[model samples]
Target: MKWGENVKKEIGQKIKELRLAKELTLKDLSEKADLSIGFLSQVERGMASLTVASLEKIAQVLEVDLAFFFTLPQKHEANIMRSYGQEVFSVEESKYFYRLASDLEGKSLEPVLIHLLPNQGREEISPYSHQGEEFVYVLEGILTVFMGDEEYKLNPGDSMHIFSSLPHEWANFTKKLVKVLCVRTPGIFQGDKG
Candidate 1:
C-alpha cells in the first residue's frame, strides 16, 4: 500500500505538537528515541516516515499511544471501526507498513496490522523487551520470530503467543510482502519503556 504524503505530514505534525506540549526539543526526543536530530527533524517536517518500531520509541518518550499519531484529537468513543482505506504508515528505516486497528484510549489491548517487506527482518540494534504479552497471526507470506536465542518460522495461518519480556523481534524472509495481525496485552503500543 502506498502511503500518502499528506498522512506523513499530519503524523509528523501531531508528533511535533506532542513534543512541544511536553516541552521537549528535537534533540531531547532524538536522544530519548535513539535517533539522530537530523532524522527527527525530517520526521517532524514530514520529510521522513517512521517505522512502527521508531514510532513506538517516540510514543514512549512522549508518553502517548502509537494510535495518537494516527488519530486526530477528539473525544474517543468506547467502540471504533476502522475501514480498510484508513491510513497506513511506514516504519523509519525499514520496509514495514502498519495501521492502527484500534485507537481507543485506555484500552487494555492494542491491535495492529503490520506488513513486513521481503528479505527484511530484525535490525542489528539491540533487542528490546517490555512488560506484556504478544499474539501474532500470519496473514500472508512468512514471518520469522526471533525470541532471544530461539527462532520460529511461521507461514500463513500460523500464530504464536509470546511473552513480551523476552527480547524478541520479527522479520520477513520471503520475496513477497508479509502481513500479520498482532495484538498485545497491556498495550505495547502505548508508552512502552523498551
Candidate 2:
C-alpha cells in the first residue's frame, strides 16, 4: 500500500481504538482531541488525513504516545537494529524522503534515517520543539542544521546534538542526497518511555 494510504488507515484504527478504550462517545472524544466532531469522525472513518500536529494532539488527549499510532504490535527484543536490507519503512515521494530508523515498539528513542534529495531544500523556518534530546549524524553529503538562531554546516561523519526543547530544522546544501541519522531520545510518543 502507499505510505500515505497505510498511514491514514492506521491512524483511523488507532483513533477508534483509543476512543473505545476511553469509553468516550464521538462528541466526548472530539472535545478532548480539540477537533471538530465531524472532522474527527472522518478521520476515524479513514476518510481524512491527520496532520502530525493533529495526531499529536489526539494522542495527548488519549493519554497515549503519538508513536503509538505508528507502532505495529509485535514481540521482540529491545534495542534491536535491523540491517540495511531489513528496513521496514522507506518511502520516496516526489518532494521528500522518509525512513524509520528504529522499530516503534518499547522504544526510548525515535530514530529517523532520512535522505533529503537536492532541490527539495527548505528555507530557514522557525525551530520546532518537542520533548527530549536530538542527535543527528551526517552520513553523506552536506547539510545545514539549524538550532534556534545558530546554523551549522555538517559534512559526512559530522554530528550535532541538542535538546529537543530547542527549535531546529535542516537543509540540504549539496547537489547530492543528504543522508542523516537522527536520534530523538525519550521518544516522541508518550508510551515510549524507557
Candidate 3:
C-alpha cells in the first residue's frame, strides 16, 4: 500500500481500538462526532480518509488528543537526528507531506518539516483548530496561509506565529514547491495523561 493509505489504515485501527476501549459503538461515536454512521464505519475500516477538521471532531468525541493518530509505537530519543530520506507522511488528502523533526517525548514543542507541492492547497479541506501555539517559517518558495478572515503570503526567510485555537489553512500558489518548518507548542503527539 502507499504511504498515505498505510498511515490511514493504522490511524483507523487506532481509532477503532480507542473507541472499543471506551465502550463506544460505531453509532455512539458517530453521534458524538456529529458524523454519519456510514462515514464513521468507512473510516474505521480504513476505506475512507479524513481531513484534520474531521479528525479533530472525532478526537474530541473520543476524548483523545488529535496527535494520538500520528504517533508511532517505537521509542523516541531525547537527542535525535534524522538523516536525509527520513520517513514522511501525508495529512490525508491535503496534498502536503510532513516529517517529524523532534523526538523529545512529552516535550512542550513539536517541530515538523512540511512540504507543499505546487497548486496543492488546504482550501479544499476544512480548516482545523486546536489548543496551543504555532510558528511557521518558510524555508523555500512561497506559502499562502489563511487564518480566520485574513490571508498572509509568506516567502522564504519569512515566519509567522499565532495561537493555534484560531481556524487556519494553507496552500502553495506558486509553481515551485514550498517547504516550511513548523513548530507547535504543547506537544500534540505526547501520550495522554488522562
Candidate 4:
C-alpha cells in the first residue's frame, strides 16, 4: 500500500477501535463529532479522505489525542535516544518534518523535534488535538502556532505550554528555517507505562 493510503487505513482502524472500545455506536460518534454518519462510516472504512479539521473533531469526541492515531505500536529497548542515526520522519498528510526525540517504549512523555520549512502554511500542516499537555520550546528561527484559531509567534528561546485538547496547527511563514522541541503526554499508547 502507498504510504498515504496505508496511513489512512491505519488511522481509520484506530478510530474504529477507539469508538467501539468506548461503547459508542456510529450514530453516537457522528452526532458528537458533528459529522454525518455516512461520512464517518466511509472514513472508518478507509474509503474517504479525512481532513485535519474533521479528524480533530472526531479525536475530540473519541477522547484521544491526535498522536494516538499516528502512533504505531513499537517496542523500543534502548532508553538513550541519540540524535545521530535517528531517522527523520513525517506524516504524509503534513509537510512538517519530525524526529522522535524520546523513543523508550511505554514512556509517559514523548519528545519530538519538529522542523518547518520556510514559507510553509497551515494548509501544509496537520491539525492536532489530544487530551494531554504539551511543552514546546523554539530552538531555531520563528515558529507560528495556531491553537484553536489563536495565533502566536515564537522565536529562539521562547517556550509555551499547550493544552493538547485544542485543535492546533503550526506554520513557518518566513524565509528562515524553523525548528522546535516539543514534549507531550499520553504517547506510546500500547506499551507498559514508565
Name the candidate that leads on lDDT: 3
Ranking by lDDT: 3, 1, 4, 2
The Cα local distance difference test for each model comes to 0.74, 0.68, 0.76, 0.71
Each prediction's Cα RMSD? 4.4, 5.0, 3.1, 4.8
After superposing candidate 3, which stretches have Cα over 4 Å from the reference? 1-3, 71-77, 95-102, 121-123, 191-194
Off by over 4 Å in 4: 1-3, 13-26, 36-42, 45-77, 84-92, 95-106, 117-130, 147-149, 163-168, 174-177, 188-194
Q: Per-residue lDDT for 5-60 in model 4, tens only?
A: 76778888999999999999999999998889998898898877665567767877
lDDT string, candidate 1, 18-70, tens digits: 99999999989999999999999998898987766677788889987776776
Worst 10 residues of 2 by lDDT: 90-99
User: Which window of ten consecutive residues has the lowest lDDT sum in model 3?
Assistant: 72-81
* Superior candidate under lDDT, 1 versus 4: 1
lDDT of candidate 2 over 38-103, digit per residue (tens): 999888987776645567667878888775777543424455544543334322221133335435
lDDT of 4: 0.71
Q: What TM-score does each of the candidates earn?
A: 0.71, 0.62, 0.79, 0.63
Off by over 4 Å in 2: 16-54, 73-85, 90-112, 117-127, 149-153, 171-176, 188-194
Clash pairs detected, candidate 4? 65-130
Candidate 1 residue-wise lDDT at 39: 91
Is 3 or 4 the stronger prediction by TM-score? 3
Model 1 regions lying over 4 Å from their true place: 72-113, 119-127, 187-194
Extract clashing residue pairs from model 1.
Answer: 50-91, 50-92, 51-91, 51-92
